[model samples]
Target: MSQNTFDGVRTAIIANKVDGIVREMTNTLLRSARSAVINSARDFSCAILTDDDQLLTAAEGIPVHVFGAQLQAQALRAAHPDMREGDAYLDNNPYVGNSHAADHTILVPVFVDGEHLFTAVTKAHQADVGNSIPTTYHAAAKDVYEEGAVIFPTVKVQTNYENVDDVIRMCRTRIRVPSQWYGDFLAELGAARVAERRLKELVAKYGVETIRQFVTDWLDYSETVMAKAIESLPAATLRNTGRHDAFDPFLPDGLDFGVRIDIKPDQGRIDVDLTENGPNVDCGLNLTEATTRAAVFGGVFNAIPARVPKNSGAFRRVVVEMNEGSAVGKPKFPHSCSVATTNVTDRLINCVGAAFAQLGEPYGVAEGAVGVGAGYAVLSGRDRRTDEDFVNQLCITANGGPGSAYADGWVTYGVPCVSGLMYRDSVEIDEIKMPIRYKHLRMVPDTSGAGKYRGAPSFEFAYTPTADPISVIYPCDGQIAPSKGVAGGEDGARAAAWLEDADGTRSQLPNTVAMVLQSGQTVHGFDASGGGYGPPLQRDPRLVLEDVLEGWETAEHATATYGVEFIDTPDGLAVDDAATERRRS
Candidate 1:
C-alpha cells in the first residue's frame, strides 16, 4: 500500500478503536455503578483527550459531563506542570473547572513507548456527596461550604495505578452511599485503564509518529469544518431574556436572566454576552463558569448538524462573554449549582436560538421543556427492615417538550434540555428499591402549547410513600410562570406539585427540599410543556381532528383553540374544512 493509504487506514482504525473504547467504558461503568441513576439512568460520560487537552471523542453522556471532563483535563495539566506517568487526579470543585461538586472527574495519563501521549477521563454524577441536606441539590445554600462536597483540582487519588486509600476513605466517610461511591470511583479508574490499553495498541500498530500526525491533522480538519459552518450562518446579533421564579429565600426580590448573542459571519465566530444578566444570588441557582460553558456547548452543538465531530477546534469559532458576578457567567463559591447548571443552561440555549431566529439562517428552534425535576424523598428514623439511614434520590427523568421545526408537529414527550439521552427507569424498578409507589405516570392530556406545529405534551406523575414515615421534596418551577410560546404560538401550561392527604387536605410543594410528606399521603408532580412555534390558526383542519381523536387534544379545545370543526362519521372523526375556515375567519 502507498504511504497515504497506510496513513488513512491507520487513522480510520484509531478513530474506530477510540469509539469502541468509549462504548466499552460506558458498559463497564454501568455494570459496576451501584446507584440507579448511573446503572439504570446512565447519567455519566466517558471520553479520550490528547495530552495537550483537546477532546478527541466522547461516548453518549450528559452534556455537562462531556464538556466538564474536557475542561477538567485542561485545568489539570495547567495546575500540575510536572504531571507524571503514574499520576492520576480527581476533582469536583466547581471553582476549579468542573460542572459542579456532585460531578466527580477522574483523569489518568496514557503513555506509549515510555512517552506520555494522552489522558483518559470519566465523569460520573453521584446522587449524594455528603451534603448537609439529604440530596446535594440544596437550593438554599449560600456558599460553597454549604453545597456539600468540594474536591480540589489535581488531587492525586492514585499513583502507578495503585489505589490511594486515604482519599477513598475521606470520600467514603463524607457521602451517604459509601459502597456506591467507592464502586463508581473504581469504575472510573477501570475506564481510564481501558482507554490507556486501547491507545497503546493503536500506537503499536500504526507507529508513534503516524498516530501523532493523525491527531494533529484530525483536529485541524475538524476546526476548518466548524469554522466554515459558522461562516455560512448569516451575520447578525440576537438577544433573548428568560426568568425563573425566585422562590429562594435569599433572593426574595425574584431573579431574572438575559442573553445577547452576536454572530459575526466575517470572522466565522459567535459571541455570547451575558454581562447584562442578573447578579449571582445567595441561592443555589448560581452557575459556575465551567457549567455555563457546558450549557453553551450543548445549545451550539444541538443547532449544528449531528454528524459534526466535537473537539477544541469547534469551540475556536465561538466566544462566550459574561460579567464576573452574573448568574449565568460567574457563580460565587459554595453556592448550590446543581439545578442551575441544567435548568438555567436550557434557558440560555433557548434564548440564544431565539436571538439567532431573526437572522433568517435556520439556525434556531422553538423552546422546549428546560426545567429539572428534583425527585427527592427522605425516610425519617431508621428503617426497621434495613437498620440503616433511609434516604434516596428518587429517579426523575427530564420530560420532553415540543421542539420547533418547519415541518410536522413538535415531538411529544421528547427530552427538552439534553435531548433524548437520559430516560426514566421503569416504575417497577423504582418501586423495588425506593419506598414510593407510583400510581400514575403518563402524559398529561392537552398540556401542549397550541400552534401550527403544536408543542410537546407535559407529564403528570402521582406517587405515595409506602413506608412508615417518608418526606418528599419537590424543587420545581413554572407554577406562577408558564413557559412562553415563540412566534405566534400559545403559552404552555404551568407546572405544579402538591401533596394530597387522606383527609382531603392539600398544599403546594415548595421549590426547596423540605419535610413535606408522610405515610399514606400522595404527591402529584406536573411538568410544564415546551412553547410552540408559528400561529395556531394556520394549523391544518385535518390534523386538528386527528389530534382530538388521538386524545392529545380535546374536541372542544380543537374547536376553540385551532378553530377546527369536526364531525362524527361512521368510521371515525372527520374534519369540516369549510366550517373550520369559516370559524377561523
Candidate 2:
C-alpha cells in the first residue's frame, strides 16, 4: 500500500486493467441482452467503483451513464448501508441518482475474503419499465406517478446471489413484454457478475492493498492531467442562454435555460451557475440534481483534451450550482423525470458549450441539436410471425449530429450525453423483429446546417404497419427550438412527424402524443439537422461541389448558401471557379 511501490508505468497498466474489467462487463451484457435497444443499439454503460463509491474506471459508452455511475453507486450504498457480499441492488429513480427512470442500474458488491473492496455497476436503458406506455421516453406523462415505470430506488433486487421473488414477480406482471424485460434484467445482472469476477481476479493477482494503492495513484494522475488542462484554458467568466422546446403542457412557450461559467485557471476551477434557469413543470422533462451534475461534467470533459481520464479526479476542478426548484437541478418528489435525461440534459450541455465557445475555447463545438432521440417514436404490437408481443423505441442513431468548429458533424452522432458510438438498428432487423416494414429510408436533401463546415445532414423515412393495428407513441424534440450554429453558422432544419392513413388522409402527430397505426397506414418523419459552423461563404468551393455531386445539396442550393458555382461536367459535377469568384466579389 506504499506510494513508492506504484510508479507511473505501473499505475498506467493498472488503470488499463481496471478499464478492461468494465469493457468485459459491457461485452457480457451486449452478448446476453435480448432487446435490440441493448444488443444492437448498445445503450448501456459499465463502471468499477471504490468501496466508498468513487469512480475508478469505466467503459466507453454513454457519457451521461458513465458519469452518473459513481452517483448511482453512492445512492445504492446510502440506501443499503448493510450491503454485503452477494448483495445486488436496482434503482432507476432520477431523484435517487440515476439519469432517468428508464436507465436502470445494477450494482454488485465485491468482497475479497472478509473485507469489502469494490463495487461493479452496470447501467442500461430498458425499453420498457412497467410504464403506462411502452417507451422509456414518456413525454406525455403529466406526473411521475403516471409516467408508467415503477421507480425502484436502491432496492435489494438480489441477496446471496439469488433473485428476489417479489421483485421478479412485480416486474413480470407489470411489464407488457415480460420475456424481453426479464432477459434484459438478467443481462444486466450478468454484466455486474462479470465485473465482480474480474475485480476479484485483479485482487488475487496483485494483492488487495497493492490494487487499492494503484487506484489511488491512478486517480491522482487523472487529477493532475485535468488540472494541467484547466490551467491552460483561457481565464474568463461567460454568461450564455439557450432554449429548449418543452413538451409539457404547462410550458407552452417553451423553457428558457441559462448558464454563467467562470473559468479560473489559476484556481483550477470552472464554476457554473444555473440559478437563472427555468423552474420545474408538469412533465417528464425535469432533471434531477445528479443528472444536472452529469450534464455539466459531460460538457467540461468533452471540451477538455482527451488525455484526461473521466474518473473522480477529472471532476475535482469543476463546481456547479443550481437552484433547488430549477428544471435542471433538484426536483421534488413525484416530479416526473422519465424523459429528463434527453433534451433537457442536452440543453444544459449546449449552454455550457456555447459559453466556452464565447470564451474562445478551441474545444467548444457549435450548439448541437443533440438528443434528436428525445422525439423518439415507440411502436408496439403483436407480431404475426411469432404471435408474440413486441415493443421498441427507435434508436437515436437514425438522426444526424450537430456541427463542430473543426469539422462537419458526423451523421447520426447518437445523443448529446453519449460518446457517439451507438449503432442504429438495421432495417432488416426491424422487419424481422417488429411488425413493420420500411417503405423508404434515406437522408433528406439540403437539410444540413449550411456553413463553411456544414453540420451533418438529417434523414427522412416512412414505414407501414404489417398488422391490422399497432400502437405508437411519439416523443420528439427540435421542432420549435432547433440546433443553432456558432459564430456565423446557420440553424439546422426542424423535425417533422405525421401519419398517412389508408384513405390518403394525413394527420400530424404532436411532439408528445400517442396514437394507433392501422393496416395500410404509413408513418413518415423528417429528422432535424445539425447547426452549421462559421459562414457559408467561407466554405471551400470544391467541398460545395462535392456536396452537390453527392446529392446532399442541389446546385442552386449550393450557390445560394455557399456562394459557390457548380457546373455539369463529364465527370459528374465541377466547381466553376470563374462564376464562383464573381459571386464572391
Candidate 3:
C-alpha cells in the first residue's frame, strides 16, 4: 500500500482506540460515582486533549459537558504554567471555562516518555456546590456572588499524588454534603487517571511520534468530513426566531431571541450569528460563552448526522458569532449563570435546529423543536428515614425531544446537549432516597406536536413530599412560548409546574423559582414536547388510529388535527379509510 494508505489505516486504528479509552473513562466515572446525578442521571463527560488543550475525542455524554472539557483543560494550563505529573486541578467557574459551577471539572496532565503530551479531563455535576440555595441553579440570585456557590477557578486539588487538605477542608466546610462532594471528587480523579493509563498503553504500543502523527491525520480527516457536509448544503441563509419564557422580573413579558445563519457552501463554512439575539437581562437565564458555543455545535452536529469525527477539526468549519452582551453570548461578570446550561441555551439550540430545517429536502426538514429547558428541583432537609442531613438537586426533567424526518421524536429523550443517554431518576430510587412519594409518572395526552411524523408525547407527573417541607427549585420554560413546528406541522404542548393543595386548590409556579412544598401538598410538572415535521393532515391515518388506541392522542384530537376518522370495528379501533380521505381532502 502507498504511504498515504498506510497512514490512513494506522490513523483509523488509533482513533478508534482513543475513542474506546475515553468511553472506558466515562464508564469508570459512572461506576465509581456516588451521586445519583452522576451515576443515575449520567450527567458527566470525559475527554482526551492535547497538552495545549485542543479538541481530541470525547466519550458520549452531555454535548455541553464534552465541549467544555477543552475549556477546563485550558483553565488548568493557565493557572499552573508548570503542570507537572501527578497534579490534578479542579474548577467549575464559568468565567474560567466551565459551563456552570455545578459541573466540577478534573484536569490531569498526561505524560509520555517524560514529556507532557496530553491532558485527560472529566466534568461531572456534583450534588452541591455551597450555593446560596442547596441546589446549583439559584434562578432568583441577582448576581454570581449572591448565588454563593464555591467558585473554584483553576484550584489545584491534588499535587505530587496527594490530596490538597486545605482545599478539601474549605469545600467540606462550605457545602452541606461534604462527604458526597468528596466522594464524587475522587470519582472524577479516578476517571482522569483511567484516561492517563489508557493513553500510556497506546503510546507504549505505538511510538510517541507515530501516535502524534495519527492525531494530526485524524483531525485533518474530521475537518474534511465536516467541510464536505457543509459544502453539500444548498447555498442559502436561513434566519430563525425563537423566545424564552418570562422569568426576568424586569421584563414582565419575557424576551425575544433571533439567530441568523449564513451558509456559505462555496466556502465550506456556516456562520451562526447570535449577534442579533436579545440583550442580556437581569436574571440567571443567560448563557456563558462556553455554553453558547456548545449549543451552536450541538445544532451543527444534529444537522450533520454523517460520521464526521467530533473534535476541534469538525468545529472549525462552523463559525459561531455571539454579541458580548447578548443572552446567548459573553455576559458581563457578576451576572448569575447558575442556570446558564438550560433556558437560553435550549432556546439557542432550538433556533439552530429551526435554521437547518429551512434548507429543505436531504439538507433539511420541518423543524422539530427541542424542549424549552431542563426541569430542576432541590430537596433540602433532614432525611427523616436515614436520620441524615440531605440536600439534592433533581436534574431529571425529560426534555422531550423534537421530531425529525427519520422517525418520531422520543418521549423524554433528553435535550440536544445531552446525547439522549442522560437517564431520568428511577422512580423507585427517588422514593427510596428522598422523602417523596410518586403519585403518577407517565406520558400526557395530546402533548405531541402534530404532523405526518409526530413529536414524542411530553411527560407529566405529580409527587408529594413525605418528610419536612422541602424547597422546590423549579427552573423551566416553554409555557409562554411553546416549541413551534416547521413547515405546516402543529406546535407542541407547553411545560407547566404547580402545587395542588389538599383542598384541590392550585397555585401556578413561575419559570424560575425556589419555593417550598408543604407536606400533604402535591407538586405537579410537565415537560414540553417537540414540534413535528410536515402537515398534520398528511399524517398516516393508521398512525392516527394507533395514537388514539395508545391514548397518546385523544380521539377528538386525531379527528380534528390529523383529519382521521376512527371507527369501532370488529377487530378493534380501525381507521375509516374512505372517511379519512374525505376529511383529509
Residue-level lDDT of model 2, residues 1-585, one tens digit each, is 245665888787888888888889989998999888888778888888888788888758677787767888878878888888898998887876788888888889999996888988888888788788777787667688898788888889999999998988898898889999899999999999988888898899999878878878877888778888889888888888877776657567777878888888898778988887777877777888777988888877755545788888777778888887667888877778877777788877766775666654255666665544322567788888898888977663456666666678787775566636677777787677788888887887788988778888887788888865888786677778888877678988877777898898998766666778889988888787777777889888988887887888988888888999877789867888999999988
What is candidate 1's CA lDDT for residue 481?
Answer: 59
| Model 1 lDDT, residue 54, Cα | 82
Candidate 2 yields a Cα-based lDDT of 0.79
Which candidate has the top score in lDDT?
2
Candidate 3: where are CA atoms >4 Å away? 1-6, 248-251, 364-375
lDDT of each: 0.70, 0.79, 0.78
The C-alpha TM-scores of every prediction are 0.92, 0.95, 0.95
lDDT of 3 by residue, 371-431 (tens): 3332457677777888887776675567667766666677767665673768888777667
RMSD of 3: 2.2
All models, RMSD in angstroms? 3.1, 2.2, 2.2
Q: On a 0 to 1 TM-score scale, where does candidate 1 land against the true structure?
A: 0.92
Q: In candidate 3, where is summed lDDT lowest over 10 consecutive residues?
A: 365-374
Clashes of each: 5, 5, 0
Q: List the residue pairs that clash in candidate 2.
A: 131-148, 131-149, 132-148, 375-475, 375-476
Two-way lDDT contest, 2 vs 3, winner: 2
lDDT of 1 at 219: 67
What does candidate 3 score on TM?
0.95
